[model samples]
Target: MSAIAIDQPTYEVGARKWLITITVITCAIMELIDTSIVNVATRQIAGNLGATVEETAWVITAYAISNIIIIPLTGFLGDIFGRKNYFTASVLLFTIASFMCGFSGSIWMLIAWRFVQGIGGGALLATAQTVLVETFPPDELNKANGIFGAGIVMGPTLGPVLGGYLTDNYSWHWIFYVNIPIGIAAAILSWKYIKGTKTEMKGKIDYWGILALVVGIGSLQMVLEEGERKDWFSSLFIVIFSILAIGGICLFILRELKAKNPVVDLRVLRFRNVAVGSALRFAFGLSIYCSIFLYPVFVQGFLGWNATRTGLLILPSAFLTGMLMGVNGALIKKGISPKALLIFGFAMVIAYEYITYMLATPAAGEWDFFWPQLVRGLGFGFIFVPAASLTLAGLKGKDIGQASGLSNMLQLLGGSVGLALINTYVARRIVAHRVDLMGNLSIYNPESNERLQMLTTQLIEQGNSSQQAQQMAMSIMERSLSTQSSIIAYGEGFMMIGVICAVILPLVFMARIKKGEALDVGSAH
Candidate 1:
């Protein structure tokens, strides 16, 4: 526990402060790292469980869906149950689910456990951010957020890297089993170090709002996760979930407006900074997640790099971003404008994405990514902390808790939507580009004729019969053409993300708060 005395000027500065900080950051990191860790091991999981690849993908979607549904509800649940007890229980739940995930007998069992794991993981994220915010005074808020931001940045990058190593050297189960020690430590630290007031539970639970929230958000997540697999509205499940999403959301709005106490509190968004902040967060999530998803797929699928190499390539970039967080904090503390930092951050994103766009080539190598990735890290350092702080700048008490939940939920939702769009776009664009490339392979095109003839001759020289050699040459040509088409499709994805970042650049001006003045929600306890 911390050593803050009664005579101390502020609870924000003490040994206990750092203890609580580490506890929350560790839990958040474990949650985040788990999010991407299973991705690289999907095939292994499918084979081990005797399931198809598509069935295994549900493991990913189930966790993601549960995360989105649970994030916004964390604050309300914490208020009802006591924040410290709730947080500690969530850690224990997450740890237990992780163990269950490792020992699952079938795909469905794994998916169910993964969903349960996400419920705990989701609460840890939002609650951790809220707890970290409460630990800092108003004047030093950005620096605290900066520390949190580093954990956020490292999680996704580390997930694939660490998962790759564990799966390659050991087995898929180690990825889940590895969480036991970290989870137990985090649970103990949270119980002892996290300090907060016990809620009064003054009014009746908003049962209607709670049901509506579950139906609305849950259905919406299903639509997003399974849309590509189910072909959007063409499938019956998508249609039903879409309708439920729409109807539930409408009922939820009406119910919250009339209720004396709301479960999620949509009313807090009436605050201007919160409104603007949510929009910015959506854009940030879209750009960041889409880029992260695209790069690994493109490099490993097209460039022929192994999963381990791909993860290693991304490590330096994430490290630079984590390192720059302190400098960003120091700058924010000195009264430099956060809006100015935001503008620069947006510029860096544009630069990173556009550079990535230009870097797309069949001949590009690992060294080509080093500088662009470093810039990417630096850009995020300037972005997430200020964006979060400015959003909750003027609010106090439960508003901060509610806003934090909303903020975290929006960002995760943004990642889901961004991933969905990227998948659709890449699928469509690949076909379009392939057709356009094939158009030039006509008999009249001398270059195409010459290349095919050269390949046929080489095959014949290697002792193949003439007819079989020509057929093989043509097959090889088709594959080469497809690979080029895929590269162009991925390049287009990067450019689309760049456009999203640019579109949000204008929102930087609308923010109402500045540096060093971010967190003023006094003594949430």
Candidate 2:
């Protein structure tokens, strides 16, 4: 491999480049924020659209499937058309779709619009990263990444909080409508400021590779999104789609390996650092996405916190993560090794998880969760920027786009799978915990008798007759048992994630990056 000279671009600090950076970063953050913003508002959306909870979830599922399908193709599209043109087009598409989403008359219409929005939104993420990297000189790349990293981590962190607030204070439709002004601003800035690298290419479009990618990623995302709801393979839809996903992905790999101008250049994986970084990215995505998904459910479902309160509780963590990313980026520029930062990051995340696991309870307050989540925010900032920088360290020019697409794809896939796994685990664990708790409630147990008698007496005082009071007391007891079981299940789930992060730590040593080699660090945006 020939070494490309790292030419520094001349620009005054906080000038045109910075404006472009902010614009592109806004686009990226808008895309990511949409990915999870609907999560907290799903129930509201379902009711408003006259749909079932399971059906309205397609608002999220459709977007995710579309996102995974489009991400790998983004780099190729950016190259074929100028990045600026493609990005402007995407922002326009996203903005129009957002308006449509807010105006939808039915759940299916909303889902369709969301899928369209995802295609547009997916481009913003990869394109933003490439644009940010190209805008900055090599020396300032870390700082640029810090800015991008803030968006990447904070978007997901703030999604629930933002969605909850919007849904509770205004209406669910506003969650989609809110993107309009931001998208329009980003579109204007992109047209005025963002520029594409000149690429001279002569090749046919990879139609076959595109087909395979859509099939593979679309089917995979469907399985991940609907698995828990459909009871996995018990449904014919799940079984058929699972087979299609596996088959399509296999063919995609083979087709990309042979294609002259593949949608996703599979050859980039030959670089050891890129390969390892991709793996770690998958794990990181799994950990981060699953934690965010689980936290909202635990707080709202088990703890009975209002959406606004839950959202407010999570806001500080996002701010802390942004601050930490800036600090970590500076530390990297000052000669701290990525590997060292990664180890510390993993340890801190594990500590955060352990704290959550130990302290989570049915009656726990928001204050009980604040500090541990803040620690998690810090750990996430440390991990994401360094990992991203290390992953593409040796690549050049177009290879950067390819690696960025591939890395982002893995993260998306990992998040989908991780959320599915956690959802399934939570369901099973709740049942198992319930059974165990029930088994301990023997008539001879003095504490059990005392609790039953107390509950019965309370029911009698509330105007129930003796037999009715006994039945009501039993119902309350069962509800209490289920509630406690859910708390334990959630705690165990967090602990399992912590263990998973700890186990992956050993792979850091095997990364084939030399200390002095210039790493290709791109913004997570």
Candidate 3:
């Protein structure tokens, strides 16, 4: 037997085992939902709080920053406080913060509460994965991972749908308020059913490691979230954060490696599977989040779709992913290689991105995206199941928690970096495309003169004077030019995701699962 199976606590069985699964998965989904739910309601939130939209963005930014900073430390926290107790406390914290957030009287007040909520929410993710891993037997681990994958896939998809519904029908506050009952139930169930463990402290706490973690990861997340808005390195704010991110991260690595009691065990990456799997997860996160960010903007901003409708466009794919999670789990149980599954998944993702790139015209409708979205769903289903199972496959007792934390942290960071890069790239492309279009729109160009004349004649025919017609024609031309530039830029952005996925696909070869590794089936199916 592997050291993990030998040293780990007894796996939960019977009804209690199932109960624990439900509890942890529920908590995880609740946390994931909060991450994206507020996005759809941001406009209403800004209006109600009397804050500018830019200022209201801080509400999301604060949550993300705290969330990333705390994610990597969850394993340590779970170890120090015991998983069950830490998880229960986190649930309570998240619940209470959600309540406070709903009742906040001002924008900054809401932002503060959201950050606290994120601290609580961050624990729910990595720790919940560990809880589920420990809850199931070795032979069923793949099943456990698949079940969790479904929740992970569905959570972000459901966020905007639920947010749009609650915000449109009621108010923005209800988005936060909605978490109250769910959090309460998750907390109660977790405390009741989840197993607990306690370990004696071996040495002084690594206070320096903790500080480095906060400074490094916090500054890095801040840079990702705010860099594009601040115009990247050109802004003093981004530059300062950039320097701190590098310095703090370097210090963090050195401290963790040499500390007697490290805040995060960086030594786990020495395992090949953990190292390669974490890198692949980073790419996976980048592709998924960038696609999510891009498609909505394209449809809503350029194609004039409503938030609810755009969200619905993503729903069918989410459903498909939920179903495929089970099938992928079964495949893994049958001795299918996780690396192969990962490669196939990325292939599907690349194909989806290519399809979307071709379909990104201004005239695209809901029906036009059906196949590509389904492909994306297939890709996610393949990726998420194997990712968790493969990354921590051979890890020993405490190492499982440490590796899980590291892997999840990298995944989130990947999404952050991808979004920042995509935002900058698309913006630059738009400006360049617009300049090119403007150059061809000169009065000396025959096509430009002919088009302007046609537009002016149409306005004149509609009873406008020649002067008014000419002015309106110019305005229409400028608007069209801008729209065209945006369309071309966004199309290229979709292709960019495919290119990135293609680059990442080859990394799967480096992640080799042993011929007959033993793992328990998870409750995902």
Candidate 4:
């Protein structure tokens, strides 16, 4: 165990601070990169591991489940151990897990290692943000946040590109191997420059809270990750886990409320800003994740694009988002109200979603996505910084950490929920659209009969018998109709998400806290 001390005087922006910041940010990028990096390689991994595509999806689901469960508790763990020690250990653990993940021969083994990787990866994300915030003084905090925000946006965007390139050129294992050198560099810098500020606590470990939390969050994540694939409540396993998840979460909330030293301080909801901010953050998470989730699927599934092409197409939008984050951060520092920025952000996102819905079609190409994706980047830029600054504006010391944890947890949960919901709706819409389109099918339908006859003639010209040509033409016609139906479903899905974002706009008025008020909650204990 590492020794603890009281919060020290604010550090100067010297070589030490800069070095530590780089280390923490690098680790953060590593963690975020893994979240989507493996997505492009999923097919390869499934083939190599002798697992079906559906079963191999556990590699992603397992990591996500562990990440959501561990993120809320990072603050408490950092407090229990020294921050530097905890962070260093997490990096080491994450690095080792990455290696194990790359080396696993079986799908289950890979999933287990990925879960362990998530335990370490979760700490890196929140802890890095807290560390960066603490390193800068109040005056320069927005600038610090902008830097951090860039990494947050960049990581996911770059993940697919890098993973796709590596998987196509070399092997999928290189995705994990690439983290090794970066991890080593971060660990060395952290050891040299990262300092610990400790707090005092006296109580038994909240084992019950931890148990309830893990059980609740883990079950909830499992349901979200697999719910669509399992046909929602139609599957017995999904139904059972859904019940456990809901029950466990309710019990966890009650336990946290009553516990003197709660694992997560549910009491922080008393602050109107924090509470409202968390809700917005959840919505933001939903929008961001769903958009990201949909983009790749649309491109690959509908357009027949390769992974590399799909990944590269997203890069410009992400860079634009990074640039916008900096601009928005500067605006916040200049005394602009966060509410205005947040409202504008939501409007921009809604517009972007509408654009996406309009542009979604079987014939849509990479160029068609560029403008809307750039708009998305700008919208996210407006949302992330101001929302976070406003939420924690009045919070001080430990509450900052707690608020951070809560906000991040909600974001994760929101992403999971949004993705699951969108996928479910997409599936339903496909069936409905298919039926609707099929209802009009008849020999008397002039356009349909002409199309079928044309296709039949082409098949017959290619040496098929008359009857076989007719059957082939019908099959092709059905496939074309199904494809159109899927495109329509995807469009509707995007539109629904836009409506959801629009609905969240009213809550911005409920936030009463002014900017610059110091929040009183201390660091996680």
Candidate 5:
């Protein structure tokens, strides 16, 4: 609403410009890695802390809720505190939280520290993008986005891998401990290299809007993350949160629309390009995290792969994504429309999902997944930069920060919703498939009788008596049936995501950027 600044920090050029890029990108990766890295270590944490796996889950749920709450507020916070100061403070907060998490003696203590860590991590991600936008000259915007995109994709991809290795060799504490050095380095670099200039934002702090956001987004995230695990609407906990989510969101939107200085500028969405780009981002997040979430479950749960082995299968694809980041950037610089690239990405991702769907069986080996994952890598390489760049393409100056924060928030929410839906869908499908499979086991079914007889004979050969052999054979058949049911359900889930990708593909055309124009231009004008 007004320009009021206490200090004006100069922007960097030359080697320092690139150094700042590295600093913020590293911070982004560290934040994202913390997002999923804890997933692999939950079991270990449960055992060590003497808690149930379900209870230990709060370690993750708390972090996610915190992330959702803080992300949309980053732009406002950066404006108020000064970007570099806020960023360095965030890094320090995250680093301190990590130290507390590592030394946590109780499960609740760890969860609390993880929540604190999430506050810091969420700020890191949103602010990192804004920082990159400010650091690069308008002409080289794609290059900045490309580097940031690689880190965005790389962080989640690397999380499970690094988590698996650390948990396997050292301990779960090391996962948190690992962040200590990285966070410290990032804080130092950000303070030293990033500009401290404040945005031209001056207004009454929208405390009411902030409270509404916490209630709304926080409740929504809780429902999404915990819904499936708690049986969705069937649980009273979910029903209460669902009501709170809807009411709080409605109230927040009303307040922000009326407030002279809203914490999140909803009006940014009126820019058609930003609006369309945000929608595209939502769909992109749904597809990306869904595929990532489902694959490991399929491999490790059904295909008999261990955590480390499952993570290793994704390594080659991650490497390919990193390389393609530069290629995609070059193409964008060569006057390519991100819409075209997004369409290509959607096609490749659809292919990857369908291929993976077909391969979801008991007999699928690592080699069977290799090519399909590479296809997924290509999809990410094409999508991340374009989706991100296009989302904020129509905004300028301070609006970039606001739009970037909101876009990132939507991306995260999409992933949360996708995970919840797939989990619920897969669970229900498994039950249905199991029931259908069970019907084929009637005494009157000749094939079933023959198979049972053969299994009985094999058990007898293994030295069991007649009755014992028969019982063992039946148990074996039941286990086999359950496994087959799960495989079918997971396969259907994969198909579901592929179909979603196809459905959202046409929306790319809705983006309205002019050909060959600089990305930072406020086309909304």
Candidate 6:
């Protein structure tokens, strides 16, 4: 690769830095919060809209697919229009969509509004990261990443908590309604405070790349989101979408590589560290998103804990994650080997998963989960900023924007793909576990006979009827089998995720990553 000019522009830093930071972080967090905030409120939304549970799920899927489609193209969009103009417009689009989402009359209407919302929200994330990086000096990029990473990790974690609260106290619409004020403020702030300096490109739009990504990513996202729901390939919808996803992606890759001006710069992956960083990013997405998806639902749904209680249980770990991000940032700035931080992060995450597998029993309580969750927060804090710093370190200024866009998109896509796989794995595990448990409970087994007799007799003593008691005994035994199977399935998930993490750990060392040490070490030392 030929050396390119690093045309980094600059401005004075003071209140401007603080203002831009708050503005972008708020916008980024708002976009992220929307990703998960509506998850818990799906049931209420279904009932209110007179839609089935299956149909209401489209509300979530619509936002996610659109978000994924737009994320990678954001860099090109910013190049076409100025970043500030594009950023401000996206915020306004998001704010308006939030209002429309709240007032939506039907489930389809809500889904449509949410799709628009996702398009806007997607730009906010990729652009916000670029803006954050530009706002700080090169040496302090890790610190900026630290602050941004805190929001990235915290947003999804807090989403369910906020959604549960809004749905419980107010109504489901309030979840969407809540975004309007925040979005409006973020939009105005982005317009006024966030400066733009990129030169606009003079060329035709990459329409082919855009269409290919939209179809490819959109279909892939759909297949991931709806595959299990539609019984994978058994449903014609899954088969068609799977084909489109594969074909579209292949076309997108070809189109981008050959295009004079690609919508996405896939060539950025050619950088040694970018490839390794992307892998780590994928792992981070898979583990973090899966943990958020499963743990709370397992606690609240299976253990009979309420939503608020579950949210509180997970909060301490998230808080620690946020604080440690700042610490890790400072460490990276002080010449800490990000490889060491990354390895530590991988180990901590695996340990957390192991603890989770061991403790995911029928009897686990809030306290039992406390330590494991805290460890997870530490793992994430260690992983995010360092990996991000490693990824973009070698890129020229021109490549950095597209590189950031692609990396962020991959991470989100990884989470979606991971969630689908986990759901399938857990479902299959439940069935396998149930089959194994049933083998021991067969009528021919001596212990099984004794237990069944004891249950029937005990029920007869209370109910005064042999026939009724026998039926009740059978029903109770079946319930126990289902419950035990579910617990075992959940427990197995931790190990599965841990093994995946272990598999990816060696890649960190293999990458020829440059250390964060440099001349402008500053006060961080």
- The runs of at least 3 residues in candidate 2 whose Cα sits more than 4 Å from the true structure, single-residue gaps closed, are 1-14, 519-525
Pick out the ten consecutive residues of candidate 4 with the lowest summed lDDT: 516-525
Candidate 1 weakest lDDT stretch, 10 residues = 1-10
**lDDT at position 265, candidate 3:** 83
Per-candidate RMSD vs. true structure?
Answer: 3.3, 2.9, 3.0, 2.0, 2.0, 3.2
Candidate 4 residue lDDT tens string, 254-333: 99989888888888888898998999989988998888888888888899998778877788888887787778778877
TM-scores for all candidates: the values are: 0.95, 0.95, 0.96, 0.96, 0.97, 0.95
lDDT per residue (tens digit) for residues 28-95 in model 5? 99998988999889999999999998889999999999998999998778777878899999999999
Pairs of residues at least 3 apart in sequence or in different chains that clash in candidate 6: none
Q: What's the distance in Å from true for residue 311, model 3?
A: 1.9
**Candidate 3 wrongly placed segments (more than 4 Å):** 1-8, 519-525
- What lDDT does each candidate get? 0.84, 0.84, 0.86, 0.85, 0.86, 0.86
lDDT of 3 by residue, 492-525 (tens): 9989989998887877788767888864323110
Off by over 4 Å in 1: 1-12, 514-518, 523-525
Clashes of each: 2, 2, 14, 11, 0, 0
Q: What C-alpha lDDT, on a 0 to 100 scale, does residue 326 get in candidate 6? A: 88
Off by over 4 Å in 4: 1-5, 515-525
Q: Which ranking of candidates, highest lDDT first?
A: 5, 3, 6, 4, 1, 2
Superposition-based RMSD of candidate 6 using all C-alpha atoms, in angstroms: 3.2
Return model 3's CA RMSD, one decimal: 3.0
